[model samples]
Target: MLWAGSKGGLEVRTSAGGATVLRGRFPYAVPTVLKDGRERLREVFEARAFAASVAAGGDIHLLVHHDFDRPLASRGAGSLEISDGDDALTFEATIAPEMRGVSYVADFLGTLSAGLVGGISPGFRVAEGGALVKRDSEGLLRVVRSAELIEISAVTKPAYPQAQIEARNWTPCTAAEDRTLVHALNRWRL
Candidate 1:
């Protein structure tokens, strides 16, 4: 599974669960160990307080979050969506600015799915209202959020399972993603 959050800087955690740890982050850092009894893994970064801000504004996208000490400017456009029953949502996207890249569409859809599925799958699933959806399309995909939707980004693809988890030039969400998610979390009902 994948976990993305930030305590101060930028943090993205993806794990399959085991003693060995695989982690990466923005600002370029090393992976550390994090254990809480049943789960023993490495936590390379913490959730940044401004995480929501960056995400909603599309600060973290299409790049590895680690090894870079400089700031990155937003390069493209995107969209966000949410399922009516809270089943799914497309929280963010970063399609090519020229809008000629159809390949990137697949990656965006996959990332959206990865975000929500990753968020809910691992004990992190918040209440029905705790989720937000975002998507970015440079082509015909026109990203949408739904329980039935199972794709994201035309150019985006999952990293090697056994490779060290790193954030690279993948799609980045807009800061609005956070605001949208916060609202969804607050408004969710049984």
Candidate 2:
């Protein structure tokens, strides 16, 4: 399983016309802990691990909590743009007002604007021979060298603590509404 870092590197911008743009960085080279049964392991993505996958230009989606059914934007639709950076995968997604009309989507947007969404994470599958495990001073270390990037998501909890989000030009939810949305989002985990 793949684990994402903490929530601190996301930004959301809404246009006067109601188009919401979500931008964030999915960082590499940050170590996160993963568990396989009773064994604990340290995992980190090498810099540029996602370069080939992003360069391939495959269709990818911006989702909430990694839910396929809750996609907010898609690369194939020209609404999601991804770029491979030196140490992270950066993405910008333009969400139309029409798309936000979907019940869950609207809720997500509101929660995001209210600063309840945690951070962004990448959903990916490691390629063959793309990861190497070695013994380190801390214990077992898994270095991911390559992977197929499938999707990016806004999550309520993160394992890595380097991601962040910001909302601009958007109306924030009321305190009562924020509380309710937070309750709802906490229950909708993956």
Best-matching candidate per TM-score: 2
TM-score of each: 0.21, 0.80
The clash count for each model shown is: 58, 16
State the RMSD for candidate 2.
11.5
Each candidate's lDDT (Cα)?
0.24, 0.71
Off by over 4 Å in 1: 1-40, 44-59, 64-90, 94-97, 101-190
Candidate 1 lDDT tens digits, 31-112:
3322223433333322231233334443332322211121111223232221211211222222333332434333433454
Locate the minimum summed-lDDT window of 10 residues in model 1: 142-151
Worst 10 residues of 2 by lDDT: 164-173
Model 1 compared with the native: what TM-score? 0.21
